[model samples]
Target: MGVTYRRILLKLSGEALMGELSYGVDPAVVHGIAEEVAELVNEGIEVAIVVGGGNIFRGMMGAAAGMERATADYIGMIATVMNAMTLQDALERIGIPTRVQTAIAMQEVAEPYIRRRAIRHLEKGRVVVFGAGSGNPFFTTDTTASLRAAEINAEVLFKATKVDGVYDSDPKKNPDAKRFKSLTYSHVLQQDLKVMDSTAIALCKDNDIPIIVFDLSVRGNIKRAVAGESIGTIVGGFCEVC
Candidate 1:
């Protein structure tokens, strides 16, 4: 099979790491992700990841409860680091070389985020896991994914979520909800589709990077999507299967 993207960025949510569990990282899910990533590495793909911290902590939730915005965001960033470490351990257990990097200074546990160093790590066939959402408040991990993807010149960004793909409406509630096969960045932004945040979408649009959104619950979906099997909705470009 021809690989559609040789260099890709995988954007994983902390909640995505929580499979069936109410909160916190699920070992099985992490292991599954690591396996998929390993498959890609074996195929000679350069993969990078930016994980969210929603499973462990949500800055918005803390802010709703009256905590200082910046403080809550910083705490949430730390939560991402925890998730990243767990993922790194899972990958390394299976003989995959991995690196955990953070935006904020945490030299004891992870390397500080350096664009050149990260690119070199990818070139060396190591999976780089980026944690901490931009090291600033009011920025989401989605934005971080887009920013990092652009920085690394990734060919595409893959978003693995619980849902199968971006729907016109909540598929669970609306039986007739529509799932798009392909959409332009303008369409996603104009409709406010839940593919990603507006800023993230805009960043990708500016960089002309395509995004593949698929369900993480299904094993092998990552590899299938990477092989251009078209198992999900694609934004910013034509569907690979099409």
Candidate 2:
């Protein structure tokens, strides 16, 4: 069968790297994810990733205290850089050609946010990792994911979540929370599903990009999503039928 989704933007939460361990990057877990993604690359899928920094720092969390908004956001951005570097090392360690592009300017370390260059890397079969949350203090990585997905003209936005799919309620708190196999963008907004930040959902909706929420914690989920297996809740023009 032909490979599905020629280009995809995979949004990975830093917390997913924990892998049942402490709150940090787990080598085994990162390597496993990299290998899975590498398999998809082998199948000719162009992948670009936007990694969240929640595992290291969340500006809003500290902002609840007396932390300055700008300061806290800068810290959060740095945390994303760290996660990006870690993921870059992991992916490259496994022989997958990779590039780390940052929103913030860091010429000595990584390349600045160059949309053309990032797209070129993907076209040349390199995994591009986007870091620093849009290079702005107020915007979140979720928004950044949507923005970059559109910029790159990706076929879909693969949102890597802890759960397998979007549920009517918090699946962690309510075991009986019904899982949705798929969903339309209007349904996600109408039902008030917390699949993504409102800003993120709005951006994707306005741009007509599909957002696929799936459990990245499960092995091979990334590849499966890229291969268009309908493994998770897809939000866009189509509705998720029961």
Candidate 3:
């Protein structure tokens, strides 16, 4: 079967790694995700991931609690690095070649993020995991995913979320919420859907990159999304929900 996208940047929230736990990563969840990603790599798909740090520590929450915003954000970035390492370990245990690149220089643990080097790693069939959230304060991991996707010229940006797709309202809170199969960048911005931050959405819109928001909790969903099986809400491009 033919795949829909040749290369993609997958965005995973730290919470996704938490599984049923209230905090920290669940080994079972990480292993499961690694298996799925390994399957994609084996299928000849170029996959790069940008993981979030909300499970370990959220910068915003720290700042609200009186920590300096920059300090809090830096801590959050370190948390992402930790998650990246954990994911790398899982992928390697399954014999999937992987690299951990961080926006911040952590030579002892991960290589400093280099666009050219990252692309080269992908060309070599190694899954590149980008960590540290752009190495900047006040920027979300979503923005990091968008920027990296454009840099790598990925065909699509896959936002792996807990939800099945983007909805008109919170699906968890409102059972009657309508899920959108497709939407325009403008509609997402105007409606404030919270699918991705405004900066991340704008970056994708500017680069003309398509964003697919799908449920990552479901096993095999990632592969289905990569195969263009119409499993989630696709944003950007000419598609519009009327």
- Most accurate candidate by TM-score: 3
- In the range 88-151, model 1's lDDT, one tens digit per residue, is 9999999999999999999999999999999999999999999987999989999999999999
State the weakest 10-residue window (summed lDDT) of model 2.
233-242
Give the worst 10-residue stretch by lDDT in candidate 3.
233-242
- Candidate 1: Cα lDDT at 231: 85
TM-score of each: 0.97, 0.96, 0.98
Looking at model 2, residue 219 earns an lDDT score of: 88
Query: 130-184, model 2: which lDDT tens digit per residue?
Result: 9888988978888999999999999899999889988999988998998887788
Write the residue-wise lDDT of candidate 3 on 1-242 in tens digits. Answer: 56999899999999999998999999999999999999999999999999999999999999999999999999999999999999999999999999999999999999999999999999999999999999999999999999999999999999999899999998889989999999999899998999899999999999999999999999999999999998889998554664
TM-score of 3: 0.98
- Residue pairs in candidate 3 whose N, alpha carbon or C atoms collide under 3 angstroms: none
Q: Which stretches of candidate 3 lie over 4 Å from their true place?
A: 238-242
- Scored against the true structure, residue 149 in model 3 reaches a CA lDDT of 100
